[model samples]
Target chain A: MFYLLGLGILCIAFLFIIGLYNLDFKYLFMISAPAEKITAAVIIIGILNCIISILFFFGVGYLREAVKAFMEKKIFQLKTVLYFKRSGIYLSSCATLGFISRSLAIIYLRVDNNGSGFGLGYSSLLIFMLICGLCFILISHVLKESVALKEENDLTI
Target chain B: MSIYINLDKVLEDRDMKSHELAEKIGITRANLSILKTGKAKAVRFSTLEAICEVLDCQPGDILEYKAD
Candidate 1:
């Protein structure tokens, strides 16, 4: 949760700094017009992301528990695998949506006849999205490895 | 990194089922299974204590030294 919150704050702060640097106050305000809308969308998406992250964390626990359960010939705990799969789905969608939103913002800036500043803003947003996308990919890989390890342990036991 | 668990042999010697041991030790069968399979990263002293108490044995009876 802290990581997500920190990332969100950092992204917003970076956007604000870029906006200030470009003096694209008008565009910023124009973007702000959709601020509530974008925020609403992000809020919904963020909530979903939160839920998914939580499920992912719990999925690890479940996987461990399931392995033990299976080894003892006890009840199979499917919750971990289910939660893990769902988290993967949710994470992918979130990343895609984030990329799309960033792309749309860049496109909006390109078409707008504001100033050269708009170009800078667009580039900054693009870079930000790229960084974020890379981070998410790395995170996904880490999660995948963890899940694989748990599965391997389950199989061996 | 290579702690060896002798839980299987202990259970065998005691003629106690894993589920029964788990119940006696106040842990879920799943957790006991983790311990038995050596998948657990760490074991609490309290849990070890419980297991020893239930099995009427020492920690060495359940765990062994294994140089990694």
Candidate 2:
């Protein structure tokens, strides 16, 4: 995903360079200067979103494992685990918002450019972010439930 | 939910301290406390087996079921 984001950013930069040079294109889908600028901004936002999303993924994994270990009554190393889990939830939320904003920016640029068809770029990105958001929500719920179960078990034992 | 753990009775019968048992099992005293308090969600099969072997008792003698 990060690679895709980087590629998109590079594509936008190339477009901007071409636009600045006032290069004539025989290609059917040529973008103008203003449109290129907008695309570049969107791509930059997309890159940021990807970076956050990657971090969130690692965070979710760490949280899930910590929760599982906690449930198993492994309490020796809990403080750090709890910290990571909390931070992961916050990062995931931020990544979701970033992805949404980037997608909207891309859509706005497309419309401004008088691009006839809806491009696959923005729609795919929106879908990916939505899926990631849902996954993170599910992960949070699972971790919460696991923690509750561990507490209950501890109380009973 | 309330669960029953008979670890205290087994430890008493075996003449073992919580810290000593924890040291033998290679787990922390806090974890042993959690197990004794019945606050642990799950126990590993290996750990359970080790406890039973050390205490010369069955799992049924150490744990009992209770409804929430």
Specify the highest-lDDT model's number: 2
Error of 1 at A147 (Å): 7.7
Reference-based lDDT, residue A69, model 1: 48
Model 2: which residue pairs collide?
A: A153-B39, A154-B38, A154-B39, A154-B40, A155-B39, A156-B38, A157-B37, A157-B38
lDDT of 1 by residue, A1-157 (tens): 6467557756664653454345334434544676554444444434443453354334334434544443565432344344334444443443455345444444544434233543345445434534544554454466567667766665332
lDDT tens digits, residues A54-139, model 2?
Answer: 65556545655655564666644435346444645654564566455445554654423222232334334334435544564565
**CA lDDT, every prediction?**
0.57, 0.58
Best by DockQ: 2
Chain A of model 2 scored by TM-score: 0.37
Encode model 1's per-residue lDDT on B1-68: one tens digit a residue.
57899999988999999999888878788878888878887788898898888889999898898887
Which ranges in model 1 have alpha carbons more than 4 Å from their true place? Answer: A1-121, A134-157
Candidate 1 TM-score, true structure as reference = 0.41
As a whole number from 0 to 100, the lDDT of residue A98 in candidate 2 is: 48
Error of 1 at A69 (Å): 25
